[model samples]
Target: MRGIVLNATLAAVKFAGGVFGNTYALIADGAESLIDILSSLLVWAGFRVAARPPDANHPFGHGKAEPLAALAVAVFIFAIAGWIAWSAIREILTPHQGPHWATLPLLAGVVAVKLWFSRRMTRASEEAGSTGLQVEALHHYSDAITSAAAFVGIGIAVWGGPGYETADDWAALLACAVILFNGVLMFNRALADVMDTAVSPEFESEVRTVALGVPGVAALDKCRVRKSGLSHLVDIQVRVDGELSVRAGHDIAHAVKDALLASAPHAISDVSVHIEPIK
Candidate 1:
């Protein structure tokens, strides 16, 4: 909720300031900020649904909804990028006169705001252990970079001699390119999450190490991992002593779960162990 509020407030300020200052680069940056606002709202909605306990309709709870929201955000970002690109292309073909000197201060102010917001949001995301928030923080960081580029371009247009009037247009074009690149990145991440791709190689190795450490476990046959918001859902098949009692097998599973949680608390949320008697 706090993330959503910050996103909304920053987006509104950037949009209004961008238009008033007549900085296309600034406007594009503002549009990117608006994307963050929309993405944050989508995440907030997903968290609401995901927080609910498992029900008959969803035996695994609604955790997957968060990834679905991420996918939606990716699609929206692509759409915004397309719009920005189209507008920028038009501007390049038929350039407009530069705005008043007042745009310089507005651009500087935006740069400062973006720097502060990105830093604060990144820390909050890490503390919350929210993948959604972390991804949004990355978006904010990108916005700050693009905003800086825009600020520089605005400065050049204001100070550079007569031939440099189109610097703002070129900057806007560059900003659009940055936005498109980010859109592609977000789309791929969303697709991978929805497809249940393997967790990072490091995370997979840690899971195997922990599972193999179980007392009676002879070997690990298979390990699968998926992320749910900030948590991980892990599934593993392990070979254990055939003579062990049911209770013993259960204890082994518990041990594996405990080890994983201790090593990477935010990485493993739920664990499922498949006990296979050693052959």
Candidate 2:
């Protein structure tokens, strides 16, 4: 919600400045911000859906929606990059008046705001362990980069007089490359989450330690942890004394599950335990 509002405000401001200031780069920036509003809304919806409890048709719940939302945001970034690049190229080919000096101050303010917001979002994403939030943070960072580039370009155009009007367009084009690079990296990360990538070894190690501490657990075999939205799902195999009764083995498995759910680094949504009796 905050992101959506901020983007809308920035978009409107940039659009006005771009038109009045005769800056195509500012207009391109405005277009990206406008699209950011839509992407932010999409992320909000994805989170709402992901928070839903398990239903009849979907046993694993709707956690996948989180990464799917991140993927969608990546797509939006790609689109805006292409659009900005094309617009910048067109503006370069056709000469125009240099951007107004006043526009530089506006862009400077935007860069500062975006940088602060990006930092804030980065911390939040890290704390929450949310891939979707991470991508959103990346979006803000890219915005800041582009705005800073525009600031420099506009500065050059303002100082260099008639000959440097096209510098602004070149800066926008450079920003497009950065945007595309970020898009690819984020897209790959989100896709990995969707594909059930394994969680970090350190996390799995913590899981093992906790499970081993449980009473009646002799040893552990295979232990696997995969990311699912804001949480993780674990599948583990345990080796027990052959002499233990079936009920005891079952109780141990339950204990392990409980320990993992309560003590794992990130929330463990589900656990699958297979018991092996060893003489």
Candidate with maximal lDDT: 2
- Which lDDT value does model 1 have at 267? 59
Runs in model 1 deviating more than 4 A are 2-12, 15-20, 258-265
Give me the displacement of residue 185 in model 2, in angstroms: 1.7
Deviation in Å, model 2, residue 120 alpha carbon: 1.6
Model 1: pairs clashing at backbone N, Cα or C within 3 Å: none
Candidate 2 colliding pairs? none
True-structure RMSD, every candidate: 2.6, 1.1
Q: Global lDDT of each model? A: 0.74, 0.90
- Per-structure clash totals for the candidates: 0, 0
lDDT of 2 at 160: 95
Q: Worst 10-residue stretch by lDDT in candidate 2? A: 259-268
Candidate 1 residue lDDT tens string, 77-181: 677767766776777677577644677777677677767877887797678655555556656766776777777777888788466666777776677677668
Candidate 1 whole-model C-alpha lDDT, 0 to 1: 0.74
